[model samples]
Target: MHHTASSHSGPDHGTPRTVAAHRQAFHDLLAAFARPENTEQLPLLAALGRGLAMDILAPLDLPPFANSQMDGYAVRSADIPDAGAELRITDPIPAGAAPAALETGLAAPIMTGAMIPPGADAVVPIELAEPDVFPVPGKAATVRLPPVLAGTFVRDAGSDVRAGELALAAGTCLGPGQLGLLAALGITVVTVYRKARVLLVTTGDEVVEPGSPLAAGKIYDANGTLLEAAMRQAGLDVLRTGISTDSPDELLLLLRRHSPAVDLIVTTGGVSKGAYEVVRQATAAQEVEFLHVAMQPGGPQGLGRFDGTPFIGFPGNPVSCLISFEMFLRPVLGTLLGSPAPRPAVKARLASPLTSPEGKHQVRRGTLLPDGTVRLEGGAGSHLIHALANSNALVHVPVGTSALVAGEEVEVWTL
Candidate 1:
């Protein structure tokens, strides 16, 4: 139970907690305040874009042998039969060297990843032979290939992945084609999954920090540069601190000085119910809770823990702290960072009419339309940060419906 909220007796909160039960109580308070993240290893050029904490296998055979995907001659396809048949070149492999065996009516000039020489089987393209280049080595050449077929350009040996297979599976994400297939399988390092540091904060005494100066009723701190650019675009690491004011002992001494380095505290404008909330009076005595989830711009929120880390909070509107980090911490940090691409939700249509409130869950912002139609861009108002900077899609609506009408469809999400 570590604090739960959303009960407001029987009227306001009793029936408001729905946005899918407060996003499944922030996925069971981040699976009981998460804490597994430690993997590392890295190196494949510092594991570009991270995430894969295991399963990579294939440490060899990804084209680890039968090479030469063309640079001319290799032969043995019944020693070039039809068209012109000249075959006699010999010695010229040049790609990492190691070719010697093609004697029977020789033709080996290779080059283009080289290696396939022991009595070759097929390559033919140095622009289809007939003296198309590489032939000098100690003179006496003869190239004229035309009958190509036995594995035509050749590149086999586990043609991409098979030194025991499963080249990349443990939550893969690396990217540039999985780090160019782990650098063509030589692999150099790679374990990954650590990232999520996150401290962020951002409370408010009327905010104001963006280039300072403002005073009458403050307001500039767009939720600390909008939740530190949405927690560094969801890859986490953040830290921030910045605004904090409505003091609850300076927000519990800034959450006990960044709760020993951070693994998720988030906060953003004291958890609502106004009158200088200060993260609901600095974790009112630890466990947290706050609530009000029916969702709209972002319905108040606030999860648990703080000294034990894992907090959450989020509400002083910058589009309700980026629609509550796109409805509860971007799908639980894309499933605790195993994120191999998650986004999803699409559907479109609604170009105009909207409303929403009978039970909660509204979202809004929109824009999608390139014929797909979504529209909205600012009105349900949660201090409209320029309508979430001219929208890019969120829409949703759900909970016992209240209005919708302009052509209808809906769903959206995609920001």
Candidate 2:
């Protein structure tokens, strides 16, 4: 059931649903809008930050063959009976070249990463030789080398990953290391889950584009740029449209027009009880459920669908809009996409005393100090967008507790 819009914005208003309840509903709404399981073959570079769709098996042994770990002389350990034993140097092997077998009691100068000769059992560094330099490839030479045990300075085949081994598991979030591994395994193309595409709608008659000159009561449209950056940073493909007017019909037309192409439609503002609540008025007849989540900085929220595309609405105030995305939308999106890794959460001491409204989860913007304390940036007002800009952390004051003393420990999510 949907909540009716009420003018009261304070804690004395109707009982609002808890943040946990809103998050659960939001997850269900996304599942309802889920499309068919799809995968796309992307090049290694393009696959970064995407979830791998299938397990990748190592086609060949990592390193492929035994190779020298340093510039050294490849020798049979038995030949080096002592440091004074001099063995005739046969040939030099450089990287990217096949090495011929080493005759018994002979040494081959092998460069780092060069494959070990077939009959060579160990590598003694050039410094360990009487003449500490490699002989000319065609020269006949003898060098006194220190003794080394078999397998010294050797990278054995399959040391890292054997052929047919599970190199990368399914659903692994591909990053630089993962992509590099795929490239090392000779994989140029990879299958990854497609990123969700979201159409963001910003509303309000007083909101003007940034490039436009501001007049009497108009403010620049920050929710568009702010939420767009947040969503794109979270790995969603963002499609932006012109800011919608306060007219419900105009907003509804925009949503319906864009819903066919995007996986989700997110709107900023017009979901509250304000007289010009375009998002609420437009989707009221449809399946949208406007809500009052038990949270400060963000309370008015709406979620449902517009022509089968998932819909979410946040408050018009810049801080509240962004906090709603962080507290409600971001976590769920990460779980759904396996990307845009979650922010680091840690326990931080409060720098000062503060009281929160009982029964509401308060999200306060703050700067996480190097001393492990969180200093509040500004008061708990939703319009303090500047505070958000200055914050490096989101301090969460959970429901049920009312006040916190200086030095009190609290949970903080580092931005």
Candidate 3:
């Protein structure tokens, strides 16, 4: 393939890349920055989305002691074989109360979760025993026991969680189920990895806020809203979000102002080779390196330090901005943020034919049918916002694909 840019040294051989090459390179760069911070203790209820700092070990044995698994008569396993007979009631045991010692020839009334008293070897459920035969008034829960193993109805201590057992491991993202377990263990708080701070900004002279009046050639600021929403939904604590025109001084000033407070700074638009690309001109003198990737829509990618803060610059086009986040930022941040990254392309049959550039990979928005078929939502233009709105997934056609046919299986990345 013909080279598109000047030579530069990289982890890969010094050669021009198809869009896939640049995307992978960008992903590697983000991955290299994936060093998560040490975990912090959060209230048990609020730890749902954080990664566990270390293995969760049970401080005490679950149940702590043997107890009845059901409402039954605690008796000796050496009792008679049949259970439809009455046994003398010696004592009553309720949950959260200590049990009385079993007498040699008498049974004890027991409820579910009631501790089994000493000298009792088995439990006969109320249903398995005969009704009260004792003529005692207002106090009759005695029952006959059916022959069973010594520990048949007993819930042994630590059955749910053994003392010192590892319940959760480090790097584990806490969920509702995990929180329930920790709560059951009586843990009031837990340690989880800290969240990354992010700053999102959008640029362009033609871009305006959503509720503002649009000029003749201006467009609504879709990137800022879309990206900022996506980042917050992904568990990032966004420090600041703003919009600026194509002014190098303004963009530089904003970056410098917010740099110290954020872990990542993401900007959309103004990174390409165009003359008015303010972000490129302003950040070039700093540590950020701008490169034209081989991918469609999101071809221009930038990485560098914005006032000593890590920055990711994406293409100005709406779709390109979103795709760059999914392909690069989302995956890395998901890992550090302790959230699941969006799923990648699943194989789906093509519903129609399409042509793609020979040297660059194409990511097209499409609607995936239940029958495992995929149809391009709109034409291959990057400006097709309505098409993107209707699409449920993005089809990833690799670099070498020049033409595709109906019924061909392709990779589809769900949005």
Candidate 4:
């Protein structure tokens, strides 16, 4: 057995497709299904990790007015032309309260963030003055300070951002600093793109839910949980449909019922040419096309529209299902959702000799060492879930290379 599904007879289907060709086809399919998510206005505090749907312009200058950056005496720089000059103190200015314009030869006590009084071109910190503290009200008070340059310790109007300037551009991903900037600009609400909603399904007669009594010849379903977690990490809103049995009618019913409510549908297993391939049989008359890509572990792949929603099917193996998602779905989703792409591949020496088929790209689970060497975690079998769990990276052995010796460099994709 080839361990993969044969290409369906259709105009869109091609026999023995290359990995690159399948990836391109998948990208085109995603583009056709890329309906723009509706935007909604959410409170600024509630918009973290969301993608901005529109540009945000500053409504007013940040700070809006000149303010003091330090708790000190506001004075004219010329008044203290020499260090240690004493100036009579006036009323203290608290934050959020206005102060009278400073008279010549006099100083006004000002706290940090207080609006700068008119005609005061400099601030001498309280520690620089003789009293070293705010002066008492209604008492004969004076402050001695060092000579300073004009505009010292002043946060001028629009210093951070000017009014009507671009505060955040459209498609910007909101994080802590971005939210802080919006708050500082006094923006209470923002428009953001809605997250993509996905309907995930896994299919197999031998697959059973975890925590159930173990029956002979039945394996617990791990693909559903694995792909669900992956989808969530990719910023998708996922609805898992548990496991569908080997009944084509049951699977089709589930798909039709949930297809209208989701942006995309993802299914694992049943795409291969095995006798119990329900997904393939269920979508036989639909537009879905099943093909075998030129890659090991995840060669059986399917993509099409079912009930007007985009659908992708993977092989039954847990490792194959994940590899398919990483190779095809992740990059396209990241592009549409404004998230980072998969971790980049790095070159590492092979710690052991390995052999691959002449034409298929082999993806082997492996452990990447700190010394830039990669050791295979499991053999090239699809059912080794324990080996997959023990590995932290995927070592990519490209096509047309049948064998490799130890210490040869290969590209490893970090998990």
Q: What's the TM-score of each model vs. the native?
A: 0.37, 0.86, 0.76, 0.76
Candidate 2 worst ten-residue window by lDDT: 3-12
True lDDT of residue 260, candidate 4: 94
Candidates sorted on lDDT, descending: 2, 4, 1, 3
lDDT of each model, Cα atoms only? 0.77, 0.86, 0.75, 0.84
Query: How many residue pairs clash in model 1?
Result: 3
Q: Which one is best on lDDT?
A: 2
Q: Quote the lDDT for 353 in model 3.
A: 91
In model 3, where is the ten-residue run with the lowest total lDDT?
1-10
Q: lDDT score of model 1?
A: 0.77
lDDT of 3 by residue, 237-325 (tens): 77655588788898888888888887778888987767798887767567666676667768777775666666788888888888777
Worst 10 residues of 1 by lDDT: 4-13
Output the lDDT of residue 397, model 2: 96
Error of 2 at 53 (Å): 2.3
Error of 3 at 309 (Å): 1.3
In candidate 3 the C-alpha lDDT for residue 192 amounts to: 74
Clashing pairs in 4: none
Q: Which candidate comes out best when scored by TM-score?
A: 2
Q: Residue by residue across 1-415, what tens digits does model 4's lDDT show? A: 0111233554224557888887877767766433455667899878777777777899999989899999999998988866458889998899999788899999999999999999998888888888898867878888788899999999999999899999988767787899999998877888877777899999988999999987999999999998999888776789998789999999999999999999889999998767778998998767788878889989988888786677898888999998888877887765554443346689999999999998999999999999999999989988888999999999999999999999999999998
TM-score of 3: 0.76
